[model samples]
Target: MTLDELRATAAARHDTCAQIKKMIVSRLDLPIEPAWITDDQPLFGRGLELDSLDVLELYVAIEAEFGVALYDSDMSVFGSVSRLADHVNPALAERAPTGSA
Candidate 1:
């Protein structure tokens, strides 16, 4: 699985940006992205309104959903939604489509 495969999977299951935002919000238990979480915005710092705790939650969420173990130092890699998509893509590629998420 590569980043391309991961993006393909996420896009396929998530479909619209709104749906993708909902999936992230629900999975990570964040009151975020009521609209669409822009692919271009940072999901960290004061950028997309995320804090370190959110990153911790995201670590858990990513581990659970994609079966990828994200290191504490690796949090920097997930700064943006695009990065998260990149980080999680290969792992997702290994999983067979569960059908419509």
Candidate 2:
């Protein structure tokens, strides 16, 4: 998987950053600016609005969708959508190319 692959996968699920932002805003009942949830802004506390529980849910969702096992450290990588994007881009890149790798 590559960045483009991940982007394509994310887009297919309507689960990309922009889509997730809308979901979070509606789900959390948050007062947010769509512009504020950039690819890099922290997604909890000072930036977005998720807490520990939300993190867990997001992790579950990500794993379920991507078939990836994210460790604790990887969880920290998701501090912001952009940060998560950083981790995910590389992870997908290193996925052994399915049967080829």
Candidate 3:
């Protein structure tokens, strides 16, 4: 692809990541800004300190906000904001960065 197309793809992924971060923060009622969460930051346990309850909330919120249902998916889907972005926005899945999943 051309440089412009590559940049546009990156921009789309970045935007999706940002939206996931905001959804996590808002849906989970976390005491932090959405921008504070990095695209690669972990979403559970040691990373964002989320738990099973948080994941349930996210499943519902994701469906409502992004029109993607992740309830039947595995826990790996919550590996990070970038990973979740791939699921919520399948267009990004093809161009997802290595190890983002």
Give the TM-scores of the predictions, in the order they appear. 0.59, 0.53, 0.91
Highest TM-score scorer: 3
Off by over 4 Å in 3: 97-101
- TM-score for predicted model 2 compared with the true structure: 0.53
Q: How would you encode candidate 3's per-residue C-alpha lDDT over 1-101 as one tens digit per residue?
A: 99999898889999999999988888888899999999989888889989998888898999999999988998888888898899999999987654643
Q: List per-prediction Cα lDDT, in the order shown.
A: 0.62, 0.59, 0.89
Tens-digit lDDT track for model 2 on 16-85?
Answer: 5565566456555668766456766778788766788877776665566545556566445666664565
Counting clashing residue pairs in each candidate, in order, gives 1, 1, 0
> In candidate 1, what are the lDDT values of residues 23-51, reduced to their tens digit?
57896676655455776567777667777
lDDT of 3: 0.89
Question: Pairs clashing in candidate 3?
Answer: none
Point out where model 2 deviates above 4 Å: 1-36, 91-101
Taking all chains together, the TM-score of candidate 1 against the true structure is 0.59
Model 2 misses residue 53 by how many Å?
A: 0.8
Better of 2 and 3 by TM-score: 3
